[model samples]
Target: MIEPMADPKLSHQLDDKTDDIKKAADVVAAHLKKLEQTQKDAKDDIGSAQWRLKESQIYNITKHFRQIMNQYNEECVAHRDRCKKAIKREFEISGIRRTDDEIEDMIENGFPGTFSFS
Candidate 1:
C-alpha cells in the first residue's frame, strides 16, 4: 500500500528530502565502519598479546578495548546528530509543524521506523 503525501506541494520535495536522508545515513554508516575497524584493531591486539594476567599488564591489555569502546560511543552520538539534522530538514521541507517535544521524540527514535519522516 502506497501512502500518498496529503499535501501535493510537498510531493515535489520528496526527492530532495530522500537525498538528505540518504546522505545522513551514509555519514552514520561511515562512522560505524570506523568504529568496526577500531574494534577489530583492539581484538587483534588482544589476540597477539602474551598475557600472564599481571596487574599492570592487564591494564595495558584492556586499554585498547576501552579506547575502541569510547570511539564507538562517539560514533553513535555522531550518528544520532546526523539523524536529527536529516529529520529536521525533512520536517521543514514537508511543512510539517511539530512541537519541540514531538521532534525530540523523532530524533531519539532515529531512522527507518514509525517515528521517521523519510
Candidate 2:
C-alpha cells in the first residue's frame, strides 16, 4: 500500500490563518460580553411603571438591543461560513458547515459570550 503525500509547505499558512481567526473570535467574544453586561444592568434598573420616562427609555434601549442582536445573528452566520471555508482550505475537511446549535455552543463554551448559555 502507498501512503499519500502531505504539503508541509502549507502548514505555516494554516497556522497563520488559525491565529487570525482566533484573534477575531476573541474580539467578538469580548464585545458579546460587554453587550450582555449592559443588558443585565438595564434589566436590574427596571423599576415599577411609575417612572414613565425611565420606562420609556428602557423600552427604546431594549428595542435597539434587539436590532443589534439581529445583526449579531447574521454575523454569527457569516463567521461560521468563514470558519468553514478557512478550515476546509487549511485542513481539507468535507461538508464543513457548522450547525447553528454547535456554533452557539462553541461560542458559549470555549470562546465566550454575554448571555448565560443556559
Candidate 3:
C-alpha cells in the first residue's frame, strides 16, 4: 500500500515548481498573442518601407523568444526528470513499487491520496 509522505512540505515544494512552469507558459502565450496582433497590424501596411523594417524587427524578436522558450522548456524537462528520480527513490526506500505512469500522475497532479503520516 502507498503511504503518505514523511514530510508534507516536499509536496508543497513540488507544487510550487509546477506552478512556476505554468506561469512561464502563460507569459509565453501572452507574448505570442501580442506578436500575432502586431503581425496582423503590419499586414495593412505591407508595401511601406517602415512596415518592412518593423516586420524584420518582429521576425528577429520572435526568433529570439523562440530560442529562449526552447531553453526554458529544456530546463523544465530536466527538472521534471530529476523530480521523478527523487520520487522513485523515495518510494523504493519506503518499500512501495509504483509504475512510471503512476509516479508521473502523482507528480503532475500532486499526490492523489492523503499526505499525512499515519
Candidate 4:
C-alpha cells in the first residue's frame, strides 16, 4: 500500500547531505592550509640554498686567488733582483747611472728615438 508523502524523511535526507558537504569542505580547507604552508617552507628553503651557493662561490674564488698569490709570492723577489742586476749591468757598460726616478720616467715616457738595441 502506498503511504501518504511524509516531509520529515526528505528533511532528514537533506540534512544528512548538508552534513556530508560540510565535512568535505572542512577536509578541503585543511588541505589548502597545508599546501600554503608547504609553499612557504619551500620558498624559505630556496632562500637558504641561494645563500649557501653564494658562500661556496665566494670560498672557491678566494681559494683560487690565494693559490695564484702563493705561486707569485715565491718568485717575486728573485724576479725583481734579476731585473735590477740586468739594469745595473747595462748602465755600467754605458758608463752611466741614472737616478731611479729618471729610469722610471724613461720607461713611462718611452726611450728617445736615438735609443737602439745595437
Most lDDT-accurate candidate: 3
Of the two candidates 1 and 3, the one with more favorable TM-score, higher being better, is 3
Per-residue lDDT tens digits for candidate 2, residues 58-116, read 56765775576677557656765664344334333443455656654653334222222
- lDDT by residue for model 1 over 40-116, one digit each (tens)? 56654554434223334445545655575567557656755655565666777787777667766854443343234
How do the residues 78-117 of candidate 3 rate in per-residue lDDT, one tens digit apiece?
A: 7677767777777777778889998898767655333221
Model 3 clash pairs are: none
Top candidate, metric TM-score: 3
Per-candidate Cα lDDT values, in order, are 0.54, 0.51, 0.69, 0.51
Off by over 4 Å in 2: 1-5, 44-118
* Reference-based TM-score of each model: 0.45, 0.34, 0.62, 0.36
> What TM-score quantifies how close candidate 3 is to the native fold?
0.62
Error of 3 at 9 (Å): 5.4
Better of 2 and 3 by TM-score: 3
In candidate 3, position 29 carries an lDDT of 67
Q: Model 1 misses residue 20 by how many Å?
A: 28
Question: 1-118, model 4: which lDDT tens digit per residue?
Answer: 0111124454356447647855765675566556545545665555687656755665565566556556654554454444444554566687787777765564334332222323
